[model samples]
Target: MKIPKIDKTILVHLALFAVALIYGANYTIAKEVMPLYISPSATILMRVLGAAILFWILVGKKRLILSNKREKIILLLSAIFGVVVNQLLFFEGLARTTPINAALIMTTTPLLVLMVSAITGGEKFTFFKIIGISLGLLGAAMLIGSKTVSDSSLPFSFVFDFNLGDLLILLNAVSYAIYLVIAKPLLKKYSALSISKWMFTLALPFVLPFGFSDLGTTNFEQIPTEIYVGLGYIVLFTTFLTYLLNAWALKSVSSSVVGIYIYLQPVLATFIAVALDKDSLTPTKLIWAACIFLGVFLVSRK
Candidate 1:
């Protein structure tokens, strides 16, 4: 049967929008399982293994790989940065921080993506955008230096007092930004599913040792079934499905458009967190989130 033809522009936007919604829910869904019931290593392991298996099972022998040495290296790098480093840091960070904080911190990815893209010569940075970068940095500093969840803390004391989880999330953002820059060229040479399949397969080896150790200690019977549902969501929707959509979007849109979709993630994440009583929205979050949002707007605007 022939698939109905959709406009490329609409398809790209739809793909990105779906990813943003998935990621938004993911912040809360993922956090509910960490350090409390699952270790970061275990969670990352599940994500990597699940995604790899699903990609292989669903994609099967229909891959369109060139299999050149250069292509292999790019895929390897993408896997390392995109999955291995990104998942490890994000889960570890989420374990230590609240869902809202993780969501807010991830907004910096677009700004970081812009900077990485500029330095790598894939994109040009303007003077207006330089100012935007400054504001974004200031916003990140404010959010990171402050307490994770409270209104009583002094608001002006952003003296580089680091929160470990928040810092790791920032590093995750950096790794992901680099991944986007690295993966852009590969999309031209291969299909998104092809890149994803190889990326996760390559990442599995690097992540195995840590995840294996964590899995050994995990007592499965103690975990509630709801948590399993959450894990299923994380592995299937957040990790697997979202990455596919993101890759497809990246194929058609500029990185700027791709980055713009991220703006919705924190909004959806925050609302879900608040409604579920998983995380609270504080005055500081509002202030810092505003700074980041405004900065993102300036940087992304043509």
Candidate 2:
């Protein structure tokens, strides 16, 4: 029997929701492995390698060959911005900054994406999208509580007294936003799995040098089972699955829509933490969630 087709819009939204949920858990899940069992460089090495291997295996010999060098260039840039810069900066930045600061800075990604897309002529700015991005950013601030800024994160006093680590995190957001915009054109011509697989594969070589020594020095036998489980989750679900989901969503939705869904990460992270008893549920959080929902709805409107 043939499987009935799912609506592309429904499928796209569902895929994005799954990506956000996976990322929400990843914030906590990844911590269980890094700085203890695996260094950030080594951890990223594992993420790229594991995801690369899985993607290659999933694609097998049926991989689509890009016929033009322009496609290769686009894919390479996507890999660098999406994986190399995005992951490495995040790890380094998070180490120097508190989660609250990182979360707030990262929430600016939607705005960055919108601005870049408009400037590049890839997207037309809309009133609803602007309001949506603003609302989502506000909701995120409310949920993460914007008051707790760490001094250590401030390395640069030249611009708004921003710290070095905070700058890196902001740059990471910018890089990923660029990746989404540049990669969107490719999505129109390739399967999400194929594009994702190639992006990770291309990213592997650039990332390998940074992580090799770290991975080589790690003591495997002494690492606990739980940490390994967390590592596996990062590689499989967070790295592999989320990328695929986002890519698939891109095939049907604009990059702005994909970017706006990031506002849900903190809201979902809060609820997940509550479920795990790592955090408490409060009325203020409920209000923030409503704002995020409204913002996402407005921004995602076609």
Candidate 2 regions with alpha-carbon error over 4 angstroms: 1-5, 125-164, 274-302
lDDT (Cα, tens digit) per residue for candidate 2, span 1-302: 99999888888898899988887777666655777778888988889999999998998767678879998899999999999999998877666554444554566677778778888987786999889778866765554443323356663211123366666777788899999999998988888888888888889999999999989999999999989898889899989999988988888888888988887776676666656764454444456556756766676678
On lDDT, the candidate that comes out on top is: 1
Off by over 4 Å in 1: 1-5, 148-161
> Between which residue pairs do clashes occur in model 2?
154-163, 155-163, 155-164
Clashing pairs in 1: none
> Highest TM-score: which candidate?
1
Q: In candidate 1, what are the lDDT values of residues 153-215, reduced to their tens digit? A: 655323345688888988998999888889988886688898899899999999999899889
lDDT of each: 0.87, 0.78
RMSD in Å for all candidates: 2.7, 5.7
Cα error, candidate 2, residue 37 (Å)? 2.1
Candidate 1 worst ten-residue window by lDDT: 150-159
Scored against the true structure, residue 154 in model 1 reaches a CA lDDT of 58
Residue 253, candidate 2: how far off, in angstroms?
0.9
* Candidate 2 C-alpha error for residue 161, in Å: 7.9
